[model samples]
Structure formats: C-alpha cells, structure tokens
Target chain A: MSDTKRFLYVNRKAPHGTVYALESLEVVLIGAAFEQDVSLAFLDDGVFQLVKKQVTTGIGVKNFAPTYRALGDYDVKKLYVERESLAERGLTEDDLMEVTHENDDEEDVSSIEIVDRARMAQIMAAQDVVLSF
Target chain B: MKFAVVVNEGPYTHQASDTAYQFTKAALEKGHEIYRVFFYHDGVNNATRLTVPPQDERNVQKNWSELAEKNALDMVVCIAAAQRRGILDEGEAKRHGKGEGSANIAPGFRISGLGQLIEAGIQADRLVVFGD
Candidate 1:
C-alpha cells in the first residue's frame, strides 16, 4: 500500500432486510487486499450482525453470519462493537461470534473490541476516511 | 482537493444519487477533483442504460453519463453489487450467457471491484458518502 491511510467502516444497520451490511462487508474484504489500515465499527443494529448461530435459510437468504470470523485472515482485525448497542439489544460479548487474528508478535488476538459510545466517537474522529453504511 | 464519492442508493426512489451528482458537479465547478465515485448496494442501478423514466422527470443515468463525459469523471459501479442487483456489463453479460443487449451499463460507468473504492479512499482528500 502506498501511503496507508486510516480507513474506518461504520456499519449501523441490521444484517438482513437491507443490503447495506453485506455491501459494507464486501468493501472491507476487497480493501483488505491492499493491506491498508482498516477498522470496522458495528453500532446500532449492526451489532446484531455478529450474533452467533444466525440461520437464514428460512428467509431464503444465505447465512453470512459465519463470514465475520474470516475477517482476521484479511488483516481486518479491528472489529469494534459499541458496548451500549449490544446492551440495548440485550446481548453480551458471549452473544458475539469469536473472531481472532494473529498479531505482529504471532500471538492470537481477539479482533472484536467492545467500546463505549464515547470511545466510538473518538474512533470515528481519528480516521482518515469514514465510510458509513 | 481530491474527493471520493460513495453512492449507496438506487435512482429515483431515493435522493442519494441525485444529491451526490449535484455535489460532484459542484465540486468540479469549484475546481476540486473527484478521484472516484464508487457505486455500491442499490447504487449500481444508476449505471444501467435500460431505464426509461417519465419524460418530464430527470434521467438519473443520463445525468451521470453526461457529467462524466463532460468532466472525464471516473464512475465505477461495483461488480459484486451490480451482479446482485442484475446490472451487467458486456463481459458479465457474455459470461452469464445473456442475449445481446443484456449489458445494461451506461456509457460513462464501468464495472469494477471494490478495490477501486479503497483506492479512491486512499487517494482522495475527502470521501463523501450519500445513503440512507
């Protein structure tokens, strides 16, 4: 990557019903190839996207819930979830699917970082580019 | 300043595309550069040449094509999103075994991967998103 910029993707919608969630993820995956500094923040209903064991066969849509786990391989290891959003949806860290990536030290590290709304604001303010979905 | 625009909605049903077009046009008028306009989600629909809107109504696709023609803008429609929304280019049409004229991409818009989007973000001074 030439002159890597801090890129952040803000996902604030539900996984299904609309296509924003999938579209946002598609960008993240494609951006991963360039090895840029990327981070994903899941707030509002986007936090629901990480709920474990999502079965969408009945809705005639592919179950893409498992794809979140593969983000680590793409070097998209910063998965930030708003702590208040999770609590608002009656979810805990246990409800989220575990996603981990190997660090520069070669140690397995969890990618998901549950942060408060204040910190989420700070994170947004710190990015070179903020792509909202 | 170099700008990157992201359109996340389709044509007429939403104002996202229209607003993005106006903003992009103004930006060019103000002597700023548009690095790229990456269409995602339903926004891929804006690249279709098959639309036949009401006579009195503004044609969204035409507006974009004309603007691009005049300004030499890089309007990229996401391949994945276009495929999901039934928008196809010449290559996609042939690969999918569709009949002639199946490719509905307009003159100024090209089908490309999301890598173009990332590149735009990396290259542009500002990345503006228009969506719901």
Candidate 2:
C-alpha cells in the first residue's frame, strides 16, 4: 500500500451552471496545497468540464474550463475520464483539452485516461478520502 | 487521524448533508479526529439559524448544530456562498445594511475562504467532502 494519502474527487455535475463542480475542484486544489496525493475523476455531466472550446463569456459567466488546466500547476496530475461516459456522449479524446489523461489504449489521445466505469468504481473504493460532487 | 469535511449541498433539500453526518459519525467511531466542517455553495443554507422543520420530521439544522457542539467540531461557512444566499455575520450584515438578526449566521460557525480548506488538508490527516 502506498504510504501517501490518496484523495479521490468525483465531479458528477457540469461546469458553469452550478457551483458543485467548481467548488469540488477548489477542494482538490486545496488538498494539493496540503501535499496530499490528489486525483480527479470526471463522471456524468462533469465531463463537460474537460470539454474543449467552451464559450461562457457569451453568457456573461466566467469560463471555468481554463481553471481545469491550473490543476497541473498545483500538482494534481491525476485526472481520469470515464470511458462509458465518452462513448455514451459520442465524444472522443480530441474533444477535450490537452491536460486530460486518456486511459483507453484504443483512443489516440496522449494525456487522458479513459477507464471503464467499473474500474472507476474500483478507484473510488481504493481511495483513503473520496469526495463526491 | 485529523480530518476535514466540506459539505456542498443544503441539509434539508438533499442527501449530501445526511451522508456527511453519517461519515463523520463513522470516522469518529473509528477514533479519527475532525479538524473542521466547511459549508459552501447551497450548503451555506445549512447554517441558517431560523430553520424550523415540521414537528414530525427531523430538524436537520438543529441536529447539525447539536452534532458540532457535542463533537467540539469547528464549522465554517464560505463567505462567498453566505453573501449570495443572504446568510451573514455581524460585520457583513452591517456592511450590507441588513439588520443584526438578518446577518448573524447560525451559532457555532465561522466565515472562511477556500484557502482554509487547503489549510485543513495540510493540518489534518484527511480532507473529505460530501458535495451536491
């Protein structure tokens, strides 16, 4: 077992409309500030946060997608994208930003992980701290 | 172990608060120490002092207060969420020109920022969240 503390932040909501996703991200960043081993998992509508070409300025909402990239600078390098979610939404790895790590060997993306939903569940079960958004 | 729990959903309307309550209980039973309980987003409503649920139903707000007091838990309400939701402290209520009664948040809580959550993680062994 890893001696480091593992934190799982599961964001299940979309960006922009509600504060759930953003606040969750903030919590993860804070966790990193404390030197904890933090990981983020985007599930359901939460995957929208990783989508590319978001235009919130037109709606007068602050574009939160840019903040997603800041996670890397904060040392939150583990970002997981659920595979079934992508398949159901007809989205490919190319639709998201470069910061995401795709786990799917089939997808040609270089940075995101596309794990199966069951595998995602396993990851959650393994974490010492799991926060759901 | 030292711990911090962030609650992002309102207590009355959702299951998030209930789940957090249960988790805290379990963690405490296992002899873990809780550092703080931060409420944000719609969760600011969890600190309302005027909540009055039906007599037949559980009074979640009062229950939360009791839990904190009994555990000697440190509770914080996010300043941003509290302002947007009209939940305020004495200083903020005066700044907003609202009456003292309108501004005082529920007792047993403090107003704080995201940085505090980070500090909680640094100071505690774990940081857990039950979000909306």
Candidate 3:
C-alpha cells in the first residue's frame, strides 16, 4: 500500500470564536511531518482566518494568524481559498495575507491557488481522508 | 471496510459526539472495522473521567468507554488539545508536574499525538469527521 495519502482539511469556521481554526492548523502542521499529500480548504467563515492586518490586542488572546505564513516552512504548500467564500464576505485576494512557499523543483517559484467552490468540492471528493473543523 | 472517526465537539453541549457514537455503533454492528476514533479540539473533553452527568442523563463518556472496550477499538484523545483543555493522562500529569490525581482520562481512551490522526487518514478506507 502507498504510504502517502491525499488528506484534505476542510475549514469552515472563523478563528477565535472557537478553537477550531487554531487546532486545525495544529493538525495540519503535524500532518505535514508525516509526508502525506496534504491540502487545506478555507471556505465559508474559514476565509476570515487568512485575512490580513488582524489585531488581537483587544482580544487578549495570542494571535495565531501569523502561523499560516509559516506553514510553507513545514512543506505544507497547498492552501486553497474558495473564491465564492471570499466573494460572499466582500473580500478579495488582496485582503488576505501573502502566503507563499518556495517551489520544491524550482527555488524561486512560489504561489497560492485560489479555487472556486466547485473546484474545492472536487478536491475534497478526491481525498483519501477528509478532516473538517 | 476500515473506518476512521474524528469527533470535533464536546459531549452534552453539542450533538456531534452523540451522533458520532451512534454512527460508530451502527458501523460496528455492520461488521465494519473501526481503525480509530480521534478526539480533537473540544472533542478531547469526551475522554475525561471527571464528567459528572445527572442520574437521568446519558453519560456520554461512559458510553464511549464501554463501546471501545467491547469492540477493542482505539479511542485517541489528541495530546495537544488534551493539554490545552486539562485532559491529562497518568504519564502526562506526571511529566507536567501535575498531581497524580490530576489525570482524569476515562477507560479505553488513550492520549496520543496528532501523528496518529494522520496515520489514521492513511490507514483507514474512510475518514468521517463529526463536528458542530
């Protein structure tokens, strides 16, 4: 049997209200070390997790939004932000934090794929494991 | 078929745990092999032995423990989530300098790292997540 499995993490909740976003990131980071084909889907209120310029000073909780930027260091590069989710929230790609990872084959290339709902659903259906939070 | 179950909510407060329990029971009755039941986020709370429900109410923790024991199932409580929520096992409580009695893990449930979750994803034929 193949050791590498296609793993998709479906994130549908906003950060801070509950521990789902932070905990989901924790799982993703851990899963990256396992060398699986890991992909993250940010849809519904989950898109708010990647919104730039978040100030948690008033919230008094440690702002973990910056950790998403570090996912690349762990070799977790596939972050699929749903286009419809962004549109529904009146957000554009410009509103999100710049998340990029150096391509494995090419040292200089880095990118983040913004997919629509249909594409995201397709990706979800193709995964060997679908972990939703 | 091998199945993996991920519970993302705490007992009583959310119906997620109850639903997951019912689904697992049904699957087991159908002779499906349960690879593992991973408790993440608030779901870790389900593994605590300290939960005290009223006499009339169903004890969700007990129900899970009994089911796991009967089926020889692997019920894993995520270590990180458990620590954050104070669901310590005997070893964890000792290593963290918490008192021996500080560990309140229920029977048939073990504290494990997130790697187990990933492993389950790879080993199981199906992975079903239950959450609010």
Which is the leading candidate under DockQ? 3
Question: By lDDT, highest first, what's the ranking?
Answer: 1, 3, 2
Which lDDT values do the candidates have, in the order given? 0.93, 0.78, 0.91
- lDDT of model 1 at position A127: 95
What lDDT score is found at residue A117 in candidate 2? Answer: 96
**TM-score to native of every candidate shown:** 0.96, 0.78, 0.96
Considering only chain A, what is the TM-score of each predicted structure?
Answer: 0.95, 0.85, 0.94
Against the true structure, whose lDDT is highest?
Answer: 1
Give a tens-digit lDDT track for model 3, residues B64-132. 999999999999999999999999989999999998688899999999999999898899999899998
Worst 10 residues of 2 chain B by lDDT: B114-123
Per-prediction fnat: 1.00, 0.62, 1.00
Between prediction 1 and prediction 2, the one with superior TM-score is 1
lDDT of 2: 0.78
lDDT of 3 by residue, A1-133 (tens): 7888888888899998888999999899888889988888999999999999888899888799999888888888889999999999999999999888887576633346789889988998888888888
What TM-score number comes out for model 1? Answer: 0.96
Report backbone clashes per prediction: 0, 9, 0
